[model samples]
Target: MRNLLLSPFTLPPPSGQTRNCGVTEVLCEACDHLGWKKPTKIQIEAIPVALEGRDVIGLAETGSGKTGAFALPILQSLLASAQRLHSLILTPTRELAFQIAEQFEALGSSIGVKTAVIVGGIDTMSQALVLAKKPHVVIATPGRLIDHLENTKGFNLRALKFLVMDEADRILNMDFESEVDKILKVIPRERRTFLFSATMTKKVQKLQRAALQDPVKCAVSTKYATVDKLQQYYIFIPSKYKDCYLVSILNELAGNSFMVFCGTCNNAQRVALMLRNLGITAIPLHGQMSQNKRLGALNKFKSKSRSVLLATDVASRGLDIPHVDCVINFDIPTHSKDYIHRVGRTARAGRSGKSITFVTQYDVELFQRIEALIGKKLPAFPTQEEEVMMLVERVSEAQRFARIEMKESTEKRKRPKAGEEAADDGEQSSGVRKKVKGGSFRGRSKRGR
Candidate 1:
């Protein structure tokens, strides 16, 4: 038997370098330059498989370094291939496309791999010109890429060898399936494909079947994966008192950057206004906002200058935000998957964070569904005395309003005397009947007739 002897001058590689060191060292070094310190479990597991040139389907909670998992490997492959044109990454949204492109630029600065970003909000001419330089990688939104492919005469993907669908579920949800299928028809059948998503819905599965060739599937967390670093809690409050409870919680928090998720743009705006009125720097992000405004709000939030961002589900998916210490659910999501993505904004990249959902009586069923999906009960946070008092006041106010409405309704049903019309108008002066206005005017007319 022959035994291999170790050389005294040779030393073993550091952590993540041994294949066992995982993504820690690479992330540590990357973060040292980009100022990140940790890699989430998704990144740790998926990166290795991706680097092995295997098609990977990664399922993890959002903000779990899922982007970096596929991105790092793509960057490394590009460098190793040393080809000017080898890979193309397709995302569902312009924001995500730009985000992925930025990450690639940050990680591939030393390697000098030219990368191009193509999205709808920007002009396609510039993108075409960028591609003319023969970039090694192209990150683009599906719709924008299709537009370029059809309109740009010189644009081509003949040299493309790697294709990645980042946030595959969202892409399918956005109705980009046809566009993706068309693009696939253009790309070489032998090219490698990677599909990444937070949750693997049926549509995503179908896409995986069509794109991936004997892919390596990786799930860092369970189906409804919750990060251990996030301290999840729920507060049961009536709908009327949600604002009051949110204000109290904001008052108590130690000024960490937080994101509040709402189900609609109107709700997000309302929450943002209420927070601003309470002296909190809150911004709103939703599809209604123009691309520039959305970018501005994201930039401000990322700058850490703003303490709170109120956003809808559209903003929830594919947003690679950093340093968000907290996530508040102003409205419990109707979709269980959305709830996971909302809270996943925090506890990102292995950072400790807290998520407090303002669950109201009406949201009980929805909250229960979320818990069932996650396979765990969400603990409740005891409302502060002030918050409770605020709730009591709200309940009292609601009762008073209910009583008033009932009284008015009962009075409306009863026949009224001509002279009594003055009373309904809230004026009992000089026996003069001043006709009420709008709805009340009709009631006054009924009495007069």
Candidate 2:
């Protein structure tokens, strides 16, 4: 068995290298169906190594085609010998779990791959029923998977052949160390393991030691690197005038699609409502939302029905939406590393894009840290103070309505009906927006502010 420890390699995969990476004819047809014309650098390096039946530690950032790298090898192996409860893929978030399952199903459709997503924000009994069937692949979050392992009857991973930990750095960052450790103990020690992450944190290093055995390292881009086509800028403004600046920028870049990142769930929701009040087509996706609602919001953004997506950190890493043309950091991230992931939502697939980070007076130190980490000072996004100030009155009204809606939504949750529990978290947000101001406003992003 030859060891492959690839260093940082440039894009545009080597000629005929990706095609010869050991995928069977069936999986090759599936890749062509998905329009995967050329494999990414990570895929070029990691897939062949993974196909060799060795443990793998892949180091790559989001949008680097890491999913295909891991998915194809596992699917190919599954086709060689069909088995139930064969592979277990763990992700840090529910969105990523579903995404991995999608890719697996799409790529393995010819081979009839059945996957189950085990995560929070859905019915446990339903998941238990799915697990009772013993799916071909299990994609899950660490905590929820442990819950089923302990509580759910007739469910276990003893026969699992593959164990994958995607976003291992974030899984540990989310305080899932004990759960991951518990899961590592329960699964078979004889199975193959795959660990992928953007950063090699200390916790990740420890996890690699415990969970993997003599894994090959596939490092693509480890530094704090942003895409060269991404035009990054920052705006220094007063804390109280953030909404005004945001409205001004949206007005300036009216037609371009955007992903606006906020600091918290409530802020994401509030910003969504405020933008809607100002006649912008915006949707919010946060951890506080129900699974269906979160998926609904994501679908809305993906289909281009909504022009702006307001999201928290949960939407930052690993979930790919290819149409976003700009990113706005409405609230600067406390962790400088998050800035990289946030801006990554755009400038994907070699398309030019832009990102604007809002730097309030109180965020100077934090902004400086981001600049230092990225190794460059970003230009200030040009803005007209008079135009921003001119929108203050209207923006203030929108803010007031957002605050009221947030309070009402909170109170509604405190007194949710038995059947309307899911509706408590922004279900009525769309209809509720139309009711504001006698339904005179049009929630469309193409319109100028």
Candidate 3:
């Protein structure tokens, strides 16, 4: 972790501010419209270098305005060149691709910059049509972009001017290395490239060498650290009493929104059902759910229709949902790097937030690894044993119902059919607990089950 304050790529005092970042008049107006008062650290450093027509490797944490660091320069260049499909931004996830497209549209609205989001789990024909029309910016996941490039007719990146790989580490982690290689081979080599990531792993460094030419590294955080405003704590509890502790935390922190992270999709769904049964407005967002349902859960949480969002790592990185008051780690992440990303969901944009991680006996080593990675020890979140016990009866009842619901849901998924909705409802109305195959009432338990 090198000191970024004295990095050679730092912008001069005069142009470090957003108003003097060398963007054109129209873009400045657009920034004003977006209510961006000044440039973030990453933007201040990387934007100036990008505006100078230099390939940039930006290292910044999540919610550090990394998008603006690349977007402003691309938008400025687009204003001058005025070509369709001039820039292409690659992300690791479908949701991130859509979020980047929205930011591009918002920033370039005054200039009428048309953009298209190309990702999986959607209509391909519509994306093909969008590609044919030639949008100003095309934001896509690497795999889907490769699919379109190999299949879509009359579509290519021979004339591309700017290429961006946002969340470059996650892109490689998701096994998009070969797809990225194919994209790099097809796109013009003369284009300017920007690789932005929170951490600089060996893969990212290798990709930077292969994809960028004489890139300037603008790193904002030299070490892994949470935002100053985030109050982080942990709780060590018995595995059996995890649900009770979670219920206590939610009740204690009532009136604020929360994003509770679980390690598995099944556990996320189970916890959501359990919380709902306990009269909490909670929704589940994970990989197993359909794309529409995942987006619905996200929308419900974002619009304040739901106060708690139970999700897996799918919502960990690159999805910016503002107004999240706290992030509860219902299940500690296996990888320490993921901890940074999970807590990052809150304490964004200069707002204060809290993060409470659950550390069972088996998670001591993993929790210590996280503390070492972040270079700090976390204090325990205070909890009263008697109060947690008071909620056990209700939580136990909800747990029973959650198990039944999970069983039925698994059965529904396994035996997919039309017109079975009514029959499923009738079975639920009868409230009979038929013995499901596999084991006792609890089918798949949490980790260590």
Tens-place lDDT digits, model 1, residues 1-449: 11111111222333645443234344346656986555567776777677667889888778777767776776555534466568899887777777888888777665565789887767668778897887878998888888988988778898788898888888888899899899999988888888888888899999888888999998876567777888999998888777667767776775688898988876675556444433456787777665666777788889987788888887777786778888999888888888887888887666789999888879989988888988898889877765456444433433343344335534643756664431221112122122212112112222121
Global CA lDDT of candidate 1, please?
A: 0.71
After superposition of all CA atoms, the RMSD between model 3 and the true structure is 8.2
Q: Between 2 and 3, whose lDDT is larger?
A: 2
Please write out the lDDT profile of model 2 over residues 303-402, one tens digit for every residue.
9999989999999998888889999999999999899888988887567889999999899999999999889999999998998898887788778778
Task: State the displacement of the C-alpha of residue 133, model 3, in Å, after optimal TM-score superposition.
Answer: 1.0
Instruction: Name the lDDT value of residue 385 in candidate 2.
Output: 98
Tens digit of lDDT per residue, candidate 3, span 1-449? Answer: 11111221222334324565776666667788887877788888898889889999999988899998999999877655577789999998877887888888888776677899998877889899999989889999988888899899999999999999999999999899999999999999899999999999999999998999999999999788889999999999998999999989998888899999999988988888777666677788888776667777788888999899998999999998888999999999999999999999999878899999999988999999999999899999999999898777768777887787887777766776775432221123224232222112123222221
Per-model TM values vs. the true structure = 0.78, 0.91, 0.89
- Best-to-worst ranking by TM-score: 2, 3, 1
lDDT scores in order: 0.71, 0.84, 0.83
* Collision pairs in model 1: 15-21, 16-21, 16-22, 31-36
TM-score of 3: 0.89
lDDT of 2 at 183: 93
Which regions in candidate 3 have their CA more than 4 angstroms from the true location? 1-18, 419-449
lDDT of 2 at 332: 99
